[model samples]
Target chain A: MIGGRLGIIVSGSLTKGVEVRLDSAISVEDIAVGRYVTIEGEKRRFFGMITDVTLDAIDQRVMATPPDVSDPFIAEVLAGTTTFGRLHVLPVLTIGGDALSLLEGPQPVKTVPVHFSVVREASEQDVEQVFGQVEEKQFYIGTPLDMETKVRLNPAELVKRSNGIFGKSGTGKTFLARLILIGILQEGAAVNLVFDMHNEYGWKGSSEDRREVKGLKQLFPSKVAVFALDEESARRRKVSTDFVVEIGYDEIEPEDIAMLRETLGLTDAAVQATYRLARRFGERKWLESFLAIEGREELNELASSLGEHEATMAALRRRLDSLRRLRFLVPHARDNAIQRILDYLDRGINVVLEFGRYTDYTAYILVANLLTRRIHAQYRERMERALGEDIAKPRPLVITIEEAHKFLNPDISGQTIFGTIAREMRKYNVTLLVIDQRPSGIDEEVMSQLGTKITCLLDNERDIESVLTGVSGKSELKAVLAKLDTKQQALIFGHAVPTPVVVKTREYGSPQSYKELGFREALELKKKAEEEAKDLWG
Target chain B: MPAKIGEVIEASSGEFTAQCYELHQPPSFGSLVKTREGEVEIYGVVSGAATTSIEPGRRPIARGREEAEEEDIYRSSPQLSKLLRTDFNALIVGHKEGQKLHHYLPPRPAKIHSFVYLCDAEEVEKFSQSFDFLSILVGAGGQADELIAASLRHAAAAHQDPRDFLIKAGKELAVLLGGETNRLNNILRRIKV
Candidate 1:
């Protein structure tokens, strides 16, 4: 290899083993072992390691020998002294070159700090180049997938399931979740049921200009349906409304009833009585059952006796009151929302249940629990009917739970509806996309069960570690994540990506700026604007 | 003989002699009394008769000329508190004064409020030897002056600190004010304490 220029020869045992003094222009502090150093006229760079530093007498006799003869001569000359270890000025060079080059100065090298093989640059013919790189997919619930970086997902893998999204306030978790749902829907592979707690998604425009619509007439006019639950029609009329529905107590199986009873914090005796009451009213239907019990003092007396002997009367009364509030069992409801969901699933259309506006954590949990159990039961029944056994068959439904950590928590008294769905969903083609800012808080088993993961800018180290543990072959991806810009930039791993990619998320319609205004500030701004407009008008 | 109110006493026990500032009349038999400073509580027996050759206790009263001089100083001295309210303003004001102020001002005291008690004659004598009681009053008066100098230094450092506002201010001040203000750039190069 050609060398740049010759400086002072500090020490040399042989031509190749010379210590040449250099100037202070170069900051060699950052140089490392595996770096490639290029000479001024050389076509290729020589790779070298930083060996050692020496300061002492300048010995000119050592520089006389040639490159080929230098190794043995230097070893012999520097033997049995401290200079033997310290004499060699720099570390050993793996690449061999001419001896004459050693009389010249060392050139700088380009550092490769991270492990990544350079792939062929983007060509005109590549689909990615033509369409432009797929922007990062902003999911409502799953980890963020950066479109800029390339990741490969295997579609033929054994893990086929839905996902859940979860995070605390202002973590942009809901936005990420919606993006995941939109991606699945775009793929046209599986139907989805999104429990949108705040009614934030399923709108045509960005989050800022989102308009509320009852049905999917604007966006997915062909395949999607949006249903809003109405309270009045659900209670007065037994008839299902257009978009509202009631879950009949009779339809809930004994086991599911037990689970619900546990979730509602009902006592054992109350649970048993509710089950019996449900079975007795099964033949007459919900409205007729109420009518049948209206004037009957005998049934009341029986209830009282049972209440005194085995159950808390107050607890039973409260459970009955709760049952009355259920939208499905209420008569004259505008539409059975659950039935519509079932119908959509049957028709293989994705449904977005936007609950984005709801802040009540308990209400969100209850809705999620109800929907998941219903879906599970429906899937099991269908699978049993088709397979002649209770073996789970792949149903083309994926449920995406946004803010999933709240519902899937093992610490909660209720059954782990989300966790159960995550574990068992794959069997019935019911997949879960669990998205959370703090992935560490999510149940470890449920997180492990998620076949695919998309990760974004994770500020928390524990979340990053948990994500890394869940996905494989992501060492390079982890390094890339350290330098990611805060946009919707993210690294996607697991079955969703064949390889990890750092991607900037695509703008969905008009970008919805969910910029929160502090309560007082928003009010003040509104009042100020109104006053200003009025003044101008006057 | 019991000590009278306002009399000073030297309670001697070998080398331990405390000059007590008597606030109340000593009782018969002259019991020793102890009271906490800055508190209303009184403890112990009353001390015996005491006297001092030093000037009798006199309430502190600001002289008319001194008060007028203080008012003048307050008006002339730049409000460092207000100046430091905004980092940008602090930089501007600090750049204006710079090293000249630092040269005239005493070194910044380690503690802003330091108190030394003059409880007894021997303690008073020891304190008198170490520090001038008159100079202490003068020293206390110069606190605001010292603060002004420190504020200037802080502002000068801030302007040279490479922040966007400081850089802009430095550039503007150079164009408008001119002269050796350009030397403020050297402030940035200096090693921080």
Candidate 2:
């Protein structure tokens, strides 16, 4: 009903996609890229996702030169000439039977939006069926551009497997993550643990524009616990840190040091010396014992005694000495950070570990691996314990990891614990919301395991190629992906939506958007509408 | 409704080809013309129109071009124009039988030498209500785009509500040439009436 009769389909082949010229009366504001539309065909209504929109002059007559360039007559003719807009719409599906029947599931449509059909802005009814009914386990992620309608996502599908959000820098990757996290929080579908490397998501964060974004802690204060690695750093930023996350030196193993070899720029001989140190003094006290030998002669004497490479041991000892100011790497802890995290998940409280000022790649990767590796073991055990037991099923957990490609790259994927979690998917009640720019760098095993990929505008072909590795209908989807705007727009497909859709992600941090994000209003209306629909269709 | 413009010189089931009785002047392109054969009234729009010399085997030859004014040359060779003639081709769009005006092509062709008359405003007004003739105007082929523009202009002038008539015709053009907006715009811009 909104923007009634936006345009009429003129001509376009099924393979090339449909070209709909806008009505002469319709303004440019009525349509845009990532807008959802509907074409009323003879037999059925075909729904489309607008991948591209372009303005066109009615003819090449605009190229004609006027006799006098200064004359108003010439300008009048040029101005009065008709120019129209063409919306290149990719038909996603068709609906023929009653609305209730479509709720069963989406039936993939291969047919095009027919010739000369009336194309209009898709109504709320079309959107509801297209994204699937919003009665339960549904959350509105964003609104499609140029619409009053909200585009919802099924959270149950998202948390049941791994998913990713990718974009180049400043393309709102973190902002999108925050919006979806709000959806997850509102739906209460799963517990979300975000490893906040930039300390931006728990409290108020600002975009590059310096506009303030309302964070998870502000939205769900009681349910979210913000644990900062450095409490002093959090205090300076005016954020309340619930617990100080510190790892015991005892938790550091030879493999933990080995994992940091590439990051620390250590050689093969240096890595061998790290393992030799772990063998000489057990895994629990190896770093402490190795650091205790300050002199090169003392390190050489220890290396000689152990029959190891003296110079290599000296290089490894020198690298370990640089871990002086790390707040998380302490000599002892009252309790393990992994146990605290498990307790939070068991109680259904989401934990966001904020690395306040420890934003270095080396510091972030080292602590994240240590925490996630131990936490994975505990969650796996918990999932196994409740497999056949009378105990209640644990809540599903989503681990939000930023810079995911660092740990998930093919070179170290076999050694990293995330590779196992990515391969296992939802088995341990834990899945990843992998946030990164370089999806091309993430392991293929993990990339294929990703259920839903919400991608922002990415210009790199390799990155786009990696993001679309095993996807069906990639050529069409590629054009859609390539056309996404640099901001707010996203191509969301996989387990949740019925088909690949380029949507203008809803407003983030606006009062109106916040009201919709609350779910108290939208969800209630959805329930009432569903009940009414059932009354009629039943 | 108007005076007899011509007689049907050539006739077919789908077309009515005629020449102006005055020889030098043919009905303007897109002007509605009709012919009567018994109870059937065949209607068409001027889709193809031209003026040519009637001499079968020879082209008109100009003489003394430099010495004579344009008018004096014509005066010197009065017989040159006697062999010249004006004619037009029509796409048999619709017909009228009995008292009812039907918006479809007539089944039978108008007989040869049947008198063709220019349609009056009342007939143009009635046909302008619906745009069934637009598809045939575009499909008529030769100078079809120009025909569409000329036809809209002629129809608009003959109607009481000229703007309303043009708008309705524009909407029809939106459907037929929706993909061909370039041509649609060209035709629509010429609807000055």
By TM-score, the best candidate is: 2
Tens-digit lDDT string for candidate 1 (A503-527): 4554444424221101223345668
Top candidate, metric lDDT: 2
In Å, residue A270's CA in model 2 sits off its true spot by 2.2
Q: After superposing candidate 1 on the true structure, give the runs of residues whose Cα lies further than 4 Å from its correct spot.
A: A1-159, A164-167, A204-217, A231-242, A252-304, A307-311, A319-339, A354-368, A381-395, A411-418, A435-441, A455-487, A500-502, A511-538, B1-193
- Model 2, A1-538: lDDT tens digits are 4637878898876666788887766666556566678888876778877766777765555446222325432223223234567778778778754363356545666676667899988887777667755553357776665554556787777889989999998888998898888788877889988899998789878865888987888767667899989888889988887788888788888878777887788898788877877888998998888888777778789989988788777777777777757877888876678888878877888899999889887788888888888888887777788886867667898989999999899988888888888898888888899999999999998999999999998888999999999876566567778877888888888887777776777677777665666734545666888999999999
Question: How high is the CA lDDT of each candidate model?
Answer: 0.41, 0.79
Give per-residue lDDT, candidate 2, residue A80.
20
CAPRI tier of model 2: incorrect
Error of 1 at B157 (Å): 37
In candidate 1 the C-alpha lDDT for residue A443 amounts to 69
lDDT accuracy of residue A29 in candidate 2: 59
Query: Which candidate achieves the best DockQ against the true structure?
Result: 2
